[model samples]
Target: MLIIPAIDIKEGKCVRLTRGDFNQKKIYLDNPRDMAIIWRKQNAKMLHIVDLDAALTGEMTNFEKIREIVTDLDIPVQVGGGIRSVDAVKRYLDIGVSRVVIGSAAVTDPKLVERLMKIYRPSQIVVGIDAENGIPKIKGWTESSGLKDFDLALRMKSMGIERVIYTDISRDGMMQGFGYESTKRFAERAGMKITASGGVTNAEDMKRLIELQPYGVDSVIIGKALYECNFPCQELWYAFEEGITLDHNFSTARKK
Candidate 1:
């Protein structure tokens, strides 16, 4: 499984919010570019970025800063937030983003996923399904969409979407660890590459996720763990080098 680090941007700074709430937020870094460099230096294969402002307001508020990080990183970058239209997605792809994650759009308009697949294929587009209490949430997790999380996953699969990023809204920025059981079930039902995100606290959590590979969880997106000094990239990198695979011992090339 791939360990992907998260860099959530708000007002051009790296920050984390509890349960995706705008009020309970903490700023970890003044500049996200430095954090991106740190993750790159730690040998991360990809970075997960979310424009919190954009997610809430449905605007491309931090596109310029995000573009800067994308340009500076050597590895691929995947971006999510306020990408409600195909034109916005085109802008990110034109700027070299490896993938664009559509969350609200996927919930509100299922046709958008079909249209995007026809234009960009399934690999380039990822649907981000953020849920609270088994129901999908949208508008940055502020509005509950009334859609069952797993049901939506099945729908996305039916629409020819090959990958999705599932995040537990209740655990987001909580540092309590990921919702492994929920993720496992979602992956099992979807039967596609599911990148788990939210509430990832340490290496143990990563271990749990890796064990769920049978459910199609190929990667995870972590944020508070690194910011709170819980899981260092260097240690995880070493663990990978030593072949100490977690969550079912799936071996992978060590990122050095």
Candidate 2:
């Protein structure tokens, strides 16, 4: 499992929104490049970035800044937010974005998925299916898609989408823990590989997620907990640098 760090950018600043609430946002850094560099220096293999401004407005507000962050990192960065069309996806990919995540587009434009997949290959595309009480949320979690996450996932899978990032809006930015059972339900129903996100609190949480690796939860995205130092980040950084994979809880939970 990979420990991917998140950089949520709003108004050109790195910020995080609690429970996907815009009014509840807290700025974490002035420059997103600085945060990307920090995670890169910490030996992160990949970075997850979301443009909060674009997510709500459907504009590439911080495209240049995102380009800078992507340029500075030797690792890949998967970017999301307001990516609606083939041109936007192409523009981002042209500038070195490893994968482009489609949120609202995935729900509103299913044919766009087919077009993008045909051109960029499946690995270069990711769909974010964020849900609240099983219904998929779109347009930065402000609008309901009137479709269950599993239904959306099934559509994406049928359209040849290989990977998806599943985030539970209620748990996002709350540091509660992974929405394992819900994610499992989606994974089982959608039958696609998933990267679980939102509310990952600590190492134990990571262990639990790792254990779900067999259930199509290949990796997870952690934000608040990691930013708040919910676990031994320094040690984990060293381990990442050394290519050391620590068994989740060293078998304590597995013993059960």
Best prediction by lDDT:
2
For model 1, the local distance difference test gives 0.86
Worst 10 residues of 2 by lDDT: 233-242
Q: For candidate 1, lDDT tens digit of each residue in 1-256? A: 7778899999999998888888888998999999999988777888999999999898999999999999988899999998998899999999999999999988888888888888997888999999988899998887889988888988888888888899988788888888877887777777888899999888788778778988788788888888788955666755643453343322233322
What is residue 55's positional error in candidate 1, in angstroms? 0.6
Estimated TM-score for each candidate: 0.92, 0.92
lDDT accuracy of residue 85 in candidate 1: 86
In angstroms, give how far residue 229 of model 1 lies from its true place: 1.2
Alpha-carbon shift of residue 123 in model 2 (angstroms): 0.4
Candidate no. 1 TM-score: 0.92
Q: Please, what are the lDDT tens digits per residue for candidate 2 over residues 200-226?
A: 888777767766777788878888887
lDDT (Cα, 0-100) at 14 in candidate 1: 94
Q: Where in model 2 is the C-alpha error above 4 Å?
A: 237-242, 245-256
